[model samples]
Target: MSAPYVLVLYYSRHGATRSMAQQIARGIEQAGIEARVRTVPPVSTQCEATLPAVPNEGDIYCTEADLKDCAGLALGSPTRFGNMASALKHFVDSTSGLWMSGALIGKPASVFSSTSSLHGGQETTLLSMMLPLMHHGMVIAGIPYSETALLNTQTGGTPYGATHVAGSDSNRPLDEHETTLCQAQGRHLGQLALKLQD
Candidate 1:
């Protein structure tokens, strides 16, 4: 079997969430494990709308195996009315088979999100993402106070998970404190996965 890996899965509409995923993946790699980053296709309202199997740019859609076999997971999405984006929730809702088989039981998982404003439901979105992972028997993790960024960050850091306060136009990139919290949450999740596996 291949070496264990942590899956960094997310849906990014304006790239801020994608940036957070990358930082989290970096921290996962620093924990001596592979980081498999994947993205989900956007949801369509049209009943018959179809999408190409491959995306035009950025990360490809996540596969069942990628999720089922992961040693850990970091799920991210843009905030949609204080919740995760539909694209990510759509992908997550399709994991019934994994849930039935208990493929993710005891695995460590973390959630992250990006919002248009500082108070724009970042924490609620993170909590929303955690629900499905919890149903799959995952051990949810959040950034502890040990990460000083959580205490000092005026913008995005939270005990629930890492977050980015993108400006109203959604053009803001992750600031230093946000980036540090993302890395710290990823590192903690990765380490926890290793410990649980052993």
Candidate 2:
């Protein structure tokens, strides 16, 4: 059988969230666990049509098995009016089967988000992402004050989760503090996953 892993699942529109996912995955790997990265497709205006099973490039779509089997989970999305984007939420909402089966119960989970402005609901979006995981009976994890970047970050770092201020144009790269927080959140969640397994 394969060793356990953390699933880094996210939805990115302009790519900042995707960058954060990569850094979080790096931290999970640092904890000596596999980081399985996955992304969800965008929502179409028409319900009759759907995205292809495989993405054209970048990470492929996340599957229920991916979520069910993960030792831990790191969920990310771009902020949309102080909430997670609809695409990520939609995918998560489809996990009722896992929730009913208690497949995710007891696993540690964390959330992260990127916003277009400094005050663009980074914390709220992170909180919004946590709601579904909570429903799945997963243990919630957050970046602790021990991560000094939470105190020093001028760009993005929060106790709710790791965050990135992507600027109004959605073009700003993640600053050093944002990157540090991402890794820190991932490491904390990964450690929790390892410790909780027993």
Q: TM-score for all predictions?
A: 0.96, 0.96
Residue 6 miss distance in model 1 (angstroms): 0.4
Per-residue C-alpha lDDT of model 1 across residues 60-145, encoded as one tens digit per residue: 78899999999999999999999999989889998999999999999999999999988999888988889999999999999999
**Backbone collision tally, model 1:** 0
Model 1: lDDT to the true structure: 0.91
lDDT by residue for model 2 over 1-198, one digit each (tens)? 678999999999999999999999999988878899999999888561366767898998999999988999999999999999999988998999999999999999999999988899988888888888998999999998999988999989899999998988888998999999999888888888888885
RMSD of each: 1.5, 1.3
- Looking at model 2, report the run of 10 residues with the lowest lDDT sum: 45-54
Tell me how far the alpha carbon of residue 69 in candidate 1 is from the true structure, in angstroms, after superposition. Answer: 0.5
In order, candidate lDDTs are: 0.91, 0.91
